[model samples]
Structure formats: structure tokens, C-alpha cells
Target chain A: MRLLSHNLLQCNVKNCKSNNFPLKIQVDKSNIINCEFRKEPLVKLIPKLDWNALAITVHNLAKNKEFPEKFSPALLDDQKFMQELHRILMETHIIEGALICEGCNKRYPIKNGIPNMILNDEEV
Target chain B: MATRPENICPPEIYYNQDEAVKYTNSTRIIEIQEQLTERCIELLNIPEGEDQLILDIGCGSGLSGAQLSEHNHHWVGIDISRDMLNVAVERESEGDLYEIDMGQGFNFRHGVFDSAISVSALQWLCVASKKSYNPVARLKKFFQSLYNSLRAGGKAVLQFYPDGAQQLEMITTAAMKCGFGGGVVVDYPNSAKAKKLYLVIQAGGDTREQNIV
Candidate 1:
């Protein structure tokens, strides 16, 4: 799954509330695609993104890249920053991994780049 | 052909590897899926040449997702079937894919998607596939989360095959209870084979009377 999608996902295992969001990514394999950078969507999506969570993901997955831990409106003016943000959000894909819920510690496995979010009856 | 797959088995079991591949490769199924997706996008009525993030619930093998890509939209697809998703991976589908049961509900951070679509999928939630499954509660959960996932003024066009008026009422009522505005649009109402029922849902948007059919 892309980090863009990951940013939107939260753990929903029964009544496991509090810190359910930003499921911890355990990456076994990851890949990157070269997508044309679009400045408009990235700028628009900035407010919706959890910068701290995204920064952590980038730190964990793309160590060579420098990303700010906090978000700022002025970051929109920096084309370089927008491009990096776009690359991290749109291009990076987690191919194989498990997303562990911080609240319940439930492991949602990712295979073939598709995370399995299906829960059992009791979990629901 | 007389019996629906949703009635026969749950999505994960019904769309096993063989079935998923067969469904994806069939020229007829592809043609129909493409046409329905085209119609759905038209009904969405998004501004031309605009890119928006879309959510595809029950996006099987990325057939409808291909249409979303063709329209230059970013999409996240969630399906219950692992085999179906494997086909999507093999095709290198552009959208992010996830294996999620729509009945149990998904928790995407509120107001993330600009719009959403589901083709021939929603009615499955109305089926009591397992002994533990309660159709009413499941439908309520599905609609509630779907309502939460879309941005304000966002819309979702869901095409489903309802068994009868009762099923239609059940589905629409659940959506309405969750604070969705808008209603069903039945296409090709005179022709049984071509008839398609689309639940055009608007979340926190001013009600528009256009396309009431």
C-alpha cells in the first residue's frame, strides 16, 4: 500500500480505541514507482496528512531522504519539499509487511502489496 | 447463471483464484464492467480533467479501478477476496489495494476520499452469509463507515443488484439512517437484463435534484 493510503488508515479491531491510528509498519519488502510529481494534490492533501506519522514512515522506510517531522503551510512553496512529499506519499509502496495495531497489537498482514484488513466475527 | 454468487457463497470463497482469473479474463465481463464504470463516473459528474482521490469498495481485480485510472483519478481499492487482489497485483494495478470486508466496516481517517464507488458489490452486505452475521447490523456498520470516509459534499455511486423492493428498501434505509442524502437511480428500468440500480449518495452536501431516475 502507498503511504498516502496508509496515512488514512486506522486500526479498527473491536473496542481497541486510543492510539489506533498510524498502524506501525513492519516492512519485509518495499518498492518505488516513478510517478510524475503533481504539486496541486500534494498541496491540497497537506492539511489531511498526519505529518508526524508520515515522517516516521519515511524515516523507517526511506532513510536517505530528509523529511520534516512537522508540517507547515510554507512547505508548499518549496518545490523540492513538495516533490519529496509526493515521492513518499504517492510513489513508495509497501510490498510485503504487517501493520501492527498499537492499541490491540493485532497484526494485519500485507501480501502482494495488498494489506489484509479483514477481521474475524469476534474482532468485529 | 440463475443463482447469484453472493447467495451461493461469501465473496472470499466465491472468488477463489480460478474464479477471479476467469472473471478478469472474460471479454464479456470486462466490457460490462467498463461500461458500468463509465456510467458511474458520468453520474459522479466531477469536473473535467480534475484529479481526485477515490475509494473503490469491493474493487475486484481492479476492473473498475482501471476506469478510475483512465479518468486520471487516484484510488484506494478494498476487496474481501485475496485471490481477486492477487490478480490485481499481477496486472500491476495503479491503485492501492487492500483486503477488507465491507460488512465489518473500514476506518479510514475521516474525510479522506473525494468520492467513492462500488460496482455490483453493496447487495452482498444484505446477505446473511454466516450464522454470526446479522444483515441489518452489518449494513448499518458499512454505511456508517462509508459516510465517515468521504469528504463533506463528497458523493458515492454504488451499483447493486437488489433481489426486490424489500432489499432495496433495506439498503436505502440503512444509508439514510447514516445521514446520507440522495436516492436510487435506476437505469434502463424497462429492460430487466440492462436494468442497473445505483445508490447515488451525497454526504453533507446540498441536495441536487438532477438525475433522479
Candidate 2:
């Protein structure tokens, strides 16, 4: 899964509140799938993003890479910034691993590049 | 298409798209639904002689149903929004359309439908803020109702946004708990638009598996 997606996910398991969102990704394995960048859609999405949270999550996931500390008007207009954003958001894929929710402490297993979220009746 | 009225509803309001571009190029929504439907048909392998009764949950503007109608099958559509249902009703053929909130319950009898489909609607059921209601619980209730409504071999096609790995797992876990056995199909991984995933659940009964192409 991309950090773009990680930013929006929050644990919904029965009032498991407080920092449930932005589930932490423990990457056991990952794969980078090359994807073409689309500028128009990226431009449309910039306004809706949580820039700081995204940067932090990307930093956590990538370790070595550093994203802009802030989203400036100039940065928003810059094509280079968008291209980098696009690469991080669309190109990164977690081929295998688990996304553990901070709130409910549920581990969503990723197999064959797809995350399986199935749970037993007792857990539900 | 005319300019959207000035008194546009808030983002929290379901099916309220102020931007005409969202509606016109809703190709993302349309394409995902088509892919899911095609997959469902392949998986079910419904015989030509048996009557095919299909139910579309949150059948907005009836676009999904319109596509299903091409197969000359019996269908029914239900939606919570009156405006959306009205649009759907106008486009409907022999099928019945009802203004029913799926979060509450489908209000159908057990094994009544041959198949069911919901697309781009579950996320709207979620109450994003304090003033809004949490429809996720209601959604679970709805899925239970759907499980009851389908025949032993019946299938339900649901297309929703995983948001992230956690959300994806949450939804799949919920579906399995609801008794659906199938995997998900990720549509358009690269598009910055709302990335959609199709979850096809087949009710366990007949050994014959339907092929989802």
C-alpha cells in the first residue's frame, strides 16, 4: 500500500479511538512498481492532502528519503514537487507485509501484493 | 449540464457532487462497476433459462443497472438519496426502484435475489465527523441482511475504497465475517482519482465456480 492510502486509514473497531488513523506500516517486504505520472490528477489531490502527515509517513516508510517540511504555494505550483509526490504516492507498492492499526491493534496481512483483511467471527 | 446551484450541500452529504466534472467524467466509477459486474457474471455463470434477479445497492443514477439491463435480466435498485433514486427511476426498465437507505437494511426476504452489487457507495455511509452518524455499524448490519437475501450460490459484488492497507483489511475481514468467499480486484492503481477495489463474494453451495473475467 502507498503512504497516500496510509494517511487516510483509521481503525473502526468499536471505539478504538486516539491515533487509530495513519496505521503504522511494518514492511517485511515491498516492491516498487513503476507507474507513469499524471499531473492533472495530482494537482487536484494536493488541496485535500495532509502534507505534514504525508511527509512524516513517507519518511517513516522510506527512511532515507526526505520530503518537504511544508507545502508552500510555490511548491504546490512546482512540477518537480508534484512529480516527486506522484512517485511516492503511486509508484511505491508493498508486495508483502502487514499494516498494523494503531487503534485496534489489528494486523492486516499482505500477500501476493494484496492485503487480506479477513477476521474470525470472534474478532468481529 | 447547467452550473451547479450556489446552495450546494457540504462534502459530508452523500451523493452531493457540486463539481459537474465529477459527474460527467465519472468514468472511474462507471469503469469499476463494469469490471465488477463482468467479474460477477463470470463467477456466477447463471444459466440462460433460470430467471436472473439482481439487486443493486446504492444504485445511484442507475448507471450500473442500465448496464445490467443490456443482458435482459430482471433487476431491482435501492438508494437512500431521493434525487439519485429519481434519476435511477427515470432510467429503469422493468425493474423496481426503491428509496431505501442500505445502512438501515435491504428489507428483502431471504434468498430473494440471484445476485447483488454495490459500487462507490459504502464510503458515503461512513460518518466522517462528530455531527455525522457512524454508518459503518449500519453497513455491517446491511451486509448481514445481504447475506440473508442471497441464495446459497448467489453472489454480491461490492466496490469500495480501501483507503489504505488497514481499511482494505477491515473491509475484507468484515466481508468474510458476513460469509463471502472471494478475493479483491484493484482497479487503476496509478490514477490519483479514488482508487476502487472490487470484492466478489460467492455464497458457498454449488461446487461449480463462476469465472470472473
Candidate 3:
């Protein structure tokens, strides 16, 4: 799973509504695949993102990296910054990890880069 | 007539390791899947020069994900079968894979996807895989979550094989109840073997938009 997907997913465990988003990334193994950066796609996707969530994940998993706590429209115009954002969001893959939901503390395991989001029948 | 695999077991069990490999290795199945995927993309009618973030529901073995990649679009795929997702991982599919049951509802943030597509998958939701499963409730959850996941004008093209008129009605009605607009498109309606059913849905878009049947 990539950070791009992680930014979108929230815990769907039944009746656990608050703080379900931005699952904490517990990375045991990670991989970086070099992909060509496209500014247009990222430009369009920027508005849809939860900036705080993205920043938090980057800070937690990607140590020493600091992105602005707030999203600035000006940042979209910077080619180098957009490239960096693309690499962090799209290229970095979580090979083995577990996403811990803040609300219910449900651990969704990631194996071989695929996240298992299946919930138990009782939970659903 | 051969019995439906859905009647035998749920997707996760039915598409076991052996079945997953056999399904991917079949030339006929691959060809059909590719053609249907291409058709779904065409029906999506995404504006030219835009790279979309697509969601592929029930993306078995990355067959449709490969097609999405060929179009240079980024995609996230969700499927119920672990064995099928393993095949997708082995294939090194460009799209991210998630082991999720569609009937359980999507977990994505609101308006995260530009468009969505499914091929040969929706019918599985209409069948009760377990004693406690309620098809109506499940279908409502699936459609409601799907409606929430797409952009306001985003579209989804789902190609499925309905068991009969009743199954088709159940699926369409659920989508409509969730505020989706548009309707079914039947291709090659005159031919029994070539007939294909596509549920072309748009999220809160212009209700007057007509589908090419």
C-alpha cells in the first residue's frame, strides 16, 4: 500500500465513528519504486487530500521529513516540491506493516504490499 | 446448465488458490476480461489529457488493473479473495490491492476517486453467501459507500451477469436509492451469447445524461 491510498482509507469497523481516519503506519519493511512524476495528476489530487493526515504520516514513517502543517495553494506550482510529494505519496510502498485505527485500535495487517481490510462478521 | 460458482460458496472460498491460478491462465477468460475492461473505460468517458484516480472493485488477478495502467491511470483495487490478490501481487500490478468485501462498504474518504469500474462482480452481491447475509442490506451498503467515494460528477461502469430480471432489478434499485443517476446499457441485445449488461451510473450528476444502449 502507498501513502496515497493510506490517506484515503479510514477504519470502517461498525459504530467506531470518531478518529477513524489517518490510520497509524507501523512499517516493518518498505520499498521505493521509481515512477515518473506527473504534476497535473498531483495538482488535481491535492485538493481532495487531507493535508494534515498526509503530513502526519510522513512525519511518523518518514523520519526527519517536515512538510508544512497546512496546505498552501502556492506549493502546487513548485515543480520540485510536487515531485517530492509524488515520490512520497506514490513511490514509497509499504511492503509489510500494520495500520492501526485510532478509534477502535483495530490492526489491519499489510502483507506483501497488500493491505487486508476484511472485517469480521461481528465487527461489520 | 452448469451451477453458478456463487451458489457453491462465497467469493473468498470459491476463488481459492487453484481456481485463482486457473482463471488467470485461461486465454479465453483473459481475452474477455480485457475486452470488457476496455469497454468499461470507454464508457467512463473521462476527459482527455487527465490522469484519473480509479477504483477497481473486484479486480480479480489484476486483469482489469493492467488495462487501467495501460491507459496511464492510477488505480486502487479491492477484492474479497486472498488467493486472487496474491496472484495480483505476483503479477506486480501497478495498482494497489486491498483484501476487502465490496458488500461491506468502501472505507475511502468522501470523493477520493474520480471514477470506478467493475467487471463480472456485481452479481455476487445479489446472492446470499451465508445464512445471515441479507442481499438487500448488503447491496444498500455497497451502493451507498460507492456513491460517497466518487466525485460529484464521477461515473462508474459495472458489467455484470444477472441471473435474471429480478437480480438485475435488485441491483439497480439499490443504486437508485443511494441517489445514483443513469441506467443500464445492454450491448448486443439481439444475440444471446454476445449480450452484455452494463450498469452505467453517475454520482449526483445531471439526471438528463443519456446512456448509449
Best by TM-score: 3
TM-score per candidate: 0.94, 0.51, 0.95
- Using TM-score as the yardstick, the better of models 1 and 3 is 3
Per model, state how many residue pairs clash. 0, 5, 0
Residue B154 Cα positional deviation in candidate 2, in Å, after optimal superposition: 1.1
Error of 3 at B143 (Å): 0.3
Candidate structures ordered by DockQ, highest first:
1, 3, 2
Give the winner by DockQ. Answer: 1
TM-score of chain A of each: 0.92, 0.83, 0.95
Error of 2 at B41 (Å): 3.6
Q: Please list all clashing residue pairs in model 1, or write none if there are none.
A: none
Q: lDDT per residue, candidate 1, B24-92, as tens digits? A: 999999999999898889889997767888999989999999999988888999999999999998998
Q: TM-score rank, highest first?
A: 3, 1, 2
lDDT of each: 0.90, 0.61, 0.91
Docking quality (DockQ) for each candidate: 0.87, 0.01, 0.84
- Report the Cα lDDT for candidate 2: 0.61
On residues A1-124, what C-alpha lDDT tens digit does candidate 3 reach at each position? Answer: 9889889999989998899989998999999998878778778778778999999888888773667788888888777888889998889999998999999999999998989898888888
In model 2, pairs of residues that clash are A117-B169, A117-B173, A118-B173, B42-B211, B43-B210
